[model samples]
Target: MFHNFLVTTEHRDFLRFLWHEDNDISKPLIDYHMNVHVFGNSPSPAVATYGLRKAVEKAETDVQDFIYRNFYVDDGLISCRTSEEAVDLLVRTQRILHDNGKLRLHKFSSNNREVLDSFPQSELAKDLCNLDLCNDTLPMHRSLGLSWDIETDRFTFCTCKDKKPFTRRGILSVINGLYDPLGFAVPVVLKGKLLMKEILSSTNSLDWDDPVPELFKKPWDVWVQSLTELEQVCIPRQYSDHSYTDSNVRLVHVFCDASKDAIGAVAYLQLFRPAGPEPTLSFLLGKGKLAPNGGSTIPRMELCAAVLGVEVADIIKEQLGIPSECFRFYTDSQIVLGYLTNTTRRFYVYVSNRVKRIHSASSPRQWTHVATEQNPADLATRSVSATQLSNSMWLTGPPCEILTKTLPEPLSCFPLVEPQNDCEIRPEVTCIKVQMDDVKPVNHKIGSERFLRFSTWESLVRGIKILKQFIYTFLKQSDIDSSEAY
Candidate 1:
């Protein structure tokens, strides 16, 4: 529930609205002028919604908090732990939206029948009933372009790929249409992004419907074919929807890694059941990005991956309402691990900034190393078929038994390279002054000069004369010896 419920009409008055309709040869003409801020043009929806948010924040505290956290544009969405709380929120939220800001919340659907009981039948969604109740199931409910099967409690994807002409712009449109906010499709979607990057980096700019270049033909076809298999994929909608009757310990495992092509991170929830001897897991969310055309080193990209991992962990903590201390960060990069653990060495600007972000999000001690072979984020950085992703341990989380045990040794022993200080060290310098009249000249050879204020030419001449005499004596002795021997 959002609009310009805050913006004054005076502020909206300055904008002009105009249109015209005229016949060619001396016929009638009509011109229309818009009266009440009807301009809809914008690069961002913020222009329309931000004003209402500000007004609500200024007056209604509860409404502001809920809308700020849950609302997008005119739609206000939220979840509740219990049916009572949901009904209360629904009533209070409607009152706030109408009273505080002239907004009406509608198109509401909920899995809990009790929550939707108070609403008029006409106002509710046509097919919002429980599917488990009968063999005939309702179609999937949609929000933010992703489909949710309320009956099954799962996030389902519907893959509909028609044989359309493939081009850079078409690829971009399709990639943009993939509403994977949770990044379950990151491994599959990243391939398309790489192709787009390749096209943009090329010498020619391609049209929206132009044929895919010969260069990208094979990879593009393989990726598009894999897209068809995405219909089979279904990730658990909730990280921990079921009761953990047997398990008390819960941990969040976030993995980070980077390849030459890209960098990525993924967060997963591990539910340990000591009695069962095998804990269960659920995929939470993940993130990925292609290497910029400008390029970066693998170590730098690894550091970026760690930063991404920390961000994902922080978001998961906030969304799941989990304790920060329980979060653990994993990465395959030794350099990143060392950077987080090393307190003695300093890093260059790029590494230092990213390391700072990682530390601020989670403690360095929380960051641990996982073997490259075991890192799930590798699937995202490198392309994978949809089949691989659907069957991959990456989406399902690692087998809980093996992933929880055998953690790596601490990274303190593997510190980063010691940083060198560039500024040079200089010896201390002193100046001394003497009066020429009171100074005494020093007598010394040039090679072994005396430390004095001044030296006279006479001392230098005497030293040279002594050296010449020693050389003459040695030569005369050698000639006499030779004559005696003959």
Candidate 2:
């Protein structure tokens, strides 16, 4: 087959020299002494030869050793391309030699077919065969790769030469199939893809469709439905105007208590007048001790505190010339409430008697219990920080300092009221002196007098009145004081 090609005259002469030793053309011809030799010269020989020579030169020593070690036969007399191929050929040649009686064949008995049949066939057997074909055809099938054979129940992968696989189901399908027998409903890839696409499409359109507006409308519709249902049920309209002849009639009552741990404890004396805003009067009765001093127990302290608060209200009623019957005391404490409400308890009996005495002395009053949340004075009974105490004081009344600032020059000349105790009176004297210094002299004379003549006791009395008036005015300005402060 090689001899039909045209050759140079010198190459023809060399070929004649090579053929002289070989009469039969079937034997592969080789010559050690030949000077001219060309490699891979059938077609595009130059490129092929150059590539092959480069590959061979670049091959590692270990690879060359492996090829020589595995393929060597008869101490390098014969060689083969691979160890497996050489082994197979050796076995075949030996078998032929044995059959000719040049060598003896070793005989072994096979196991029974029934025994072999007892073992189950592996599921991978068909897959292995399919894998072999897939590997063989991969180079040709570029656009359309072979798919896994579902009918054969084989789990195999396919590859393409250039283009990506088209017909082949991915690893997800194989996993789904394997899990199917285990009763798990693994999601189908096609179905999952479709669902994902649908979700993506919806998400893409969300902005354009104004989904937020639609979402808002749903809640609005629900609200409308709820309102409609509410409308179906009859509800009485709130009366804007209510009439009452006696504004002095009190309705709400309060009682309060405190312990040594609670120093600035206060309670409310709420008087719910029919024709006026509820009169919420707050009174601070010192509660909780700084140190253990022989004093009333928590309950007794509470009762005493309640009494002190009531006494304050009475004093206010007298000082302001308001009727006592117009006030109603409120308390959350059951003990205090019992003392005021219960006629049977000895202490309550005493309280009732005292109340009767007050009523006889002045006018009748009411007392009642209130839920703690509604009782504003509950805050005072609890332990409070300085800030909280200041805030509560501001809410209840004007601070003494603020009152001093707001008072008229004539009113500012008055001395602060002092307790009867000498120890308590000394602090008042100091505070009054400081306040007197703070008061600036008025330039204008009143009624031809350079300054108003004032006695110390009279000044103290007037100072108390001015402070009380300032408290009322400040309370009127604040939201927490309620409209009753007027």
Candidate 3:
């Protein structure tokens, strides 16, 4: 694939290499430059991708769209409803890339035996090349990190036996090695993450290569041993047997919850078929994140989980092309439900910002309350073993009761805020103005004569000065009256 694109003359300088000719050390080293993008070159992927897209510029709309959306570097993955459609798409894509860019598109694998029969065995994946499609069962193939079981058409997990030191780095490597982009194993993997967090946060700081504390050793070993059970866990690749567009009603339910140790959200696709007696429910995605350090209230943690639920729901909605109105959000915590459904109450900064995010993507009418035991996201916020995860409702989807039950009356029916104490609720403060009756000023003569009216020394002095002024005015007027009488 990389050899299909020729490197420009100016850029070939960066691809120059020194080589010894004919294994003769006596001879001077020969400098050679690569004319084409080669493997191991950093720019090869981008260059090849651009070249591939450029080659298919005038191809069929479907082919162009598939190339643009499905191709990851060299490999292209897509799903089709019918075996014929799959075969046709692969054939056309292969022919277009080969005719235009001289690129070979091969090693194709599909769950349908008919689809494989349409292509030559030489072009099939290495595992399928020698197999007799008629006599043998299809084998498991790894696609984009996830193990694909073509026989069952389901995605499965396999654990690697690579042993590493039980140090911080080793533990982290084991945790990161599990590539679950769809979050199928998030709950199980979350246990390992929490364990690593505990080890790193020990009172004494430990280096990457340093051994973890002895106290955490047993739990770490237990987690490592549990990986073997992951092979038992498998999820359907296709959401439902029937196409969602054919269904009578399609709904997306997202459940979010939080625990002291973690917070998380899980989404499921519910398809109501017109003819089928019961609706089909499938797990779409699951996400588990550790709670913020320094402690957080359950309500706040639950709020974080709600935000995560909205994000997960958005992704599922966009991928599934489901309408936002058909999506509903569930939370076990009434506080979170209140936060999402709140219309009149103002919240503190933390709750306000998160509430705004939830409201922006979803409406108050879309959120409703669910009992704790019924919430599938509960598995995400807490630790669960591989066995539990394989059998947990988190994978199989929400409980049967939830699947059949009607959605509660819109957010209007639910209480806006809890009657009891809630920390997230911002206290409402009111300012009231009182109009006191007017108090008339005291007459100077009356105030001076009544010494008891003056409480403080300053008031008494003020009253005395007022009395002296009054006496001087009266005396001046009396002198005039006396002189006139004489």
Candidate 4:
């Protein structure tokens, strides 16, 4: 792809490099000029992308938006409703790029055998080039670094079997090694994160090489064994059967929940079909995080989870091209719903900052309440084995009651409690100031007039000392005058 773009004449000099012929010391070094962008060149990626974009703009094709949105640098990933549409779009894109910029768009692979058969064998991915589509079973392929089984059209996980010592470094390596970028494995991985946090905190002399405490050994072993079960779990790559062209009402439901240990949020894409009574719910994405250190209250944690839910919703909305109005947020906590719906009451800084963030991305009307049992995000706040997750609603989605056209009566509008009762609320403080009729204004140089000018603590302290001295002198002088008058 980088080879497709020719470097401008003036810039070729900067890309020049020294080369040796056949690695023979007998020959002198030869200077070469790079006429085309090469791998590792600083501007090569941008040049290639810009060339593709320019080609897309000039080409008369329907896949312009597809290329722009789906292409990550050179790899193009897209999904179509039918094999025919997929083939047509890809072929047109290939032709346009080839004719316009001499760019070859190849290595195409698809879940549909018809789509694969449409392309030339050479154009297909290397693994598919030699396989007989009719005789051989479809093999699993890596899409953007995730294992995708083309035969099943599902995403699968594989555990790294490499062995390591039972030490902090090894534990960390194992934790990060399982790369579920979409957070499909978050609930399972979250337990590991909480364990690591505990190991790091409770063990004072813990070094990278030091083994975890004996009490944690069994738990670590159990967690490691559970990873093998992840291979059994498979998630559908495609969200729904119907495409964007279908007359279906699309909605995104984001559920958030928190426990003592962690906070979690999950978003699902729901489609209300005209024929089907129940809406189809597909897992979009999920996120789980260990609660921050130094301790936090349940209400505060719930607020944090709400913020996370909004964040997940925003990402889904942006990627899916869905509008904000189509999104609905769910939380099991009345306190959190109260915080979001509260209009008259002000909150303390911790709650205020998070509430403001939630409000920025979503409005209060978009949020509703769900019972603890129905909130799928509950699975994320605590530990769940791979087997449990495979069957759990965390991946399957929430109960139908929550997705109905008319949501359960918004949890009784829980009135925002008084600030004094809730620490999260900022209590209204009143200050009384008395003015003396005979007292003159403070000195502009050293009194409250100069307080705002001090930018640092030291300067402010010094200014306050000067102001105190001035006030003492003025009061003493007034007393002396009163005595003389008497």
Which regions of candidate 3 deviate over 4 angstroms? 14-34, 38-44, 404-408, 416-425, 429-486
Q: Which of the two, 1 or 2, has more lDDT? A: 1
Q: How should the candidates be ordered by lDDT, best one leading?
A: 4, 3, 1, 2
Off by more than 4 A, model 2:
1-255, 262-292, 345-365, 389-486
The alpha-carbon deviation from the true structure for residue 432 of candidate 1, after best TM-score superposition, in angstroms, is 24
TM-score of each: 0.73, 0.24, 0.83, 0.82
lDDT of all the models against the reference? 0.70, 0.35, 0.84, 0.85
The per-residue C-alpha lDDT of model 4 at residue 402 equals: 64
lDDT of 3 at 61: 96
For candidate 1, lDDT tens digit of each residue in 89-142?
Answer: 777777766676566666677766666666776556767533333344546788
The window of 10 residues in a row where model 1 has the poorest summed lDDT is 418-427
Per-residue CA lDDT of model 3 for 345-386, tens digit only, reads 788799899989998888877777788888888988776899
How many backbone clashes can be found in candidate 2? 10
